[model samples]
Target: MSSTRTGLLLVCLAGVLWGTGGLALEILRDHSPLSVLMVSAYRMLVAALALLVASVVLRRGPRLLALVRAYPGRSVAVGLGTAAYQALYFGSVTTAGVTVATVVSLGLAPVLLAVVDLVRARHRTVTRGTLRLALVLGAALSGLVLVSAASGSGAAVGTRPVVGLLLAVACGCVYAATTALGSTVLTSADADPLALTTVATTAGAVGLVPVALVGGGPFVTSDPVALGTLGYLGLFTMALAYGLFYTGLRTTRSGAAVVATLLEPVTAAVAAAVVLGERLGLAGVIGSVLILTAVAGLDEPGA
Candidate 1:
């Protein structure tokens, strides 16, 4: 396969892995949502450690260290955004139902990001293709609304009502900004890929430590299944997924990259139906198709 095709494959794989988080967490529903948060924290921690070990084993420690030193500030900023996004996302899932929270959070992120991109494009005129992509995004969000209506379940996930929604929106915003910032940092630093992953993951883990502390220790399950799931999250979803996403972004346009990442929700919906045996009503199914179509439209050349 050509390089672009290979990058696209990696990007889609990353989206699929990310989408699996909800289903994986569902398997551990008996645990506290805080436990989910702790698991996420630990995922980063483990991912960072694993990458560090791999770097050493591969005799790339010097290159990794050089990159870390060169881009310390950017790494810290990206880490902070990543940490906040994860915490708020887990918190949102706790406050809102998984499907509701995931839809709202992920759906709104690109909208906010598009607005930001438009503002940034003020100096440079917006292209017709961008406008078309925006329309498709709007259609996708409309589909989310329809899907949400079809579900008909209304139990709040968190203690704070409005605050939870606000936090979830904030999480979306942070994620959008982080994607933009991370791409810039990675390109400018000319860093060792493994080292950057390790630094960002470690930084995110460190940020989550206080939340883990406040929530109390022995944060997650000792059970083999739960531990195994968390391990997959760390090794594949958090580490490998993000690494592939960044690599893909290096070869793809930002707009196309965001649209491609929408595959996460499509994968999540399918997983929910197949693994969790959750039925999407007719409206939900229609909405899913519309959303997928819109996203595919956005991925068209020049869109």
Candidate 2:
């Protein structure tokens, strides 16, 4: 198979792995004392630790440290964004159903990125494509409003639907910011994606430690299920999925990779419906469709 096709498959696998994240968090909420913030912290910590161990085993410790020293500011920014993304996303899932949280957070990021790019390129001549982009943004916003305003009987336990939607939007914004910032570092001639990810993940864990301490109580859990779930989250969702995504990006067009990542929300929605019994109302479903459509449309070939 062509490298591009292999990259597509890898990205799709990453998305599917990400789709399971919300459900896993939900399971932890039921079986463990860890709050959303604590879960986020632990996930980052474990992933970072795993990466560190691997770097040592592969004799890349010096190279990883050099990368961190070379791009301190970018590394910190990426870490902050990563922490914000995880905290907001997990909070959304805790308050909203998996379907809503996944759709809003994952769906909004690409549109946000496209808008940022357009603003940055304001000096360029406006064209029909620019107008189309505006239309897509409008549709996305309208959909967001619909989803946020939706009220029905299908909400998850303790669902604060509106708040959840807002958190999801915030998650998307953070995700977009981090992606843009990380891209700048990743595109450098001598960039090592794995080392970069390790630094960011480790920094994120350190940054969130205080929040987890202050906001989350009974942080230690002896539940085997919870412990295992957290391990799965760190190892599979954050570490493995991120590794696959960066590796795939080496061979795939950025736009194509973005489109392939849309599988995340689709898989999340299906899993929520089948495994978690979280149903979406008509308005919520419509909003999800609009958001996904806009995000996909905003992704251009070379993006």
Candidate 3:
């Protein structure tokens, strides 16, 4: 198979794995959101350990460590941003409904990142095509609003308070900023994607420790289902999915990679429908289509 096709396949698989975490999270809803956050934190720590071991075994230790040492500042910043994103996102969902938090956070992230990119491009002139891409992204933002409105009646829609919704938006902005900064730093360093992921995950896991502490009680695994859910999320969603995504990007064209990652929201939506029995109204369906269309329109041909 062609490298591009292989890359696309990897990305799709990554999305599937990533999507599975929501199901896991649903299964673990018995626990407090903070407890769940702790589970996620531990998962990151485990993933980092696993990746570190793998790197050594594969004789990539020097390279991985070198990358970590070289970009210590950028790596830590990205990792902290990632950790903050998770904390705020969980808090949002806890206070607000999942629908509200998810829409506000995930939907706004790309828009913010695109704006950042545009601002950076001001040092250089943006082409007409880039401007068109911006417009398409704007449409995607509109679609997110429509989707949120359509799905607003669900329990997860207003579960959290207004403050939670605001926090979720803040989470989105932080996530966007970290992602943009990470991309720039990684590109500049020619960092190994897996190694980069390992560093960021380590940083995020460390950052979560204090939050988990304050919100903490003894770690209790009273239920087998909860344990299983946590396992799935930590291993598959947080670790493996990210690994596949970065590796896939190495092979895929940049445009194709972005398009593939855009599948994340669609995957989440479908998972919600199937696992949570959350029905998407006609408006929601229309909004989903619009989002896909907008993403496709924004992806530059040679990106």
Number of the predicted model whose lDDT against the real structure is largest: 2
TM-score of candidate 1 relative to the true fold: 0.86
Per-residue lDDT of candidate 3, residues 1-303 (tens digit): 666567667766776686567667767876534376777676677777777777778888777788878998887787789788878987897888776777788777776666555565563666775767666666676667666666555554445488898999998888677766666665676788778777777888888877787777665566777766766777788778877876665665333344345556566666778767898778778777876776556344422
- In what order do the candidates fall by lDDT, top score first? 2, 1, 3
Clashes within 3 Å, all models in order: 3, 0, 6
Which lDDT tens digits does candidate 2 get at residues 89-196?
A: 878877876557766786687677766666666738777767776666666666555544452235564359899889989998888778777766766647676787
RMSD of 3: 3.5
What TM-score, computed on C-alpha atoms, does each candidate reach? 0.86, 0.75, 0.82
TM-score winner, 1 or 3: 1
- Cα lDDT of candidate 3 equals 0.70
Stretches off by above 4 angstroms in model 1 are 1-8, 30-34, 119-126, 146-159, 217-220
**Candidate 1 residue lDDT tens string, 165-282:** 8767888888888877776776675666567777788888888867777877566566777777777878988889888887776665454556567777667667877876777678
Task: Look at candidate 1 and give me any clashing residue pairs.
Answer: 94-157, 95-157, 95-158
lDDT of each: 0.72, 0.73, 0.70
Say which candidate scores most in TM-score. Answer: 1
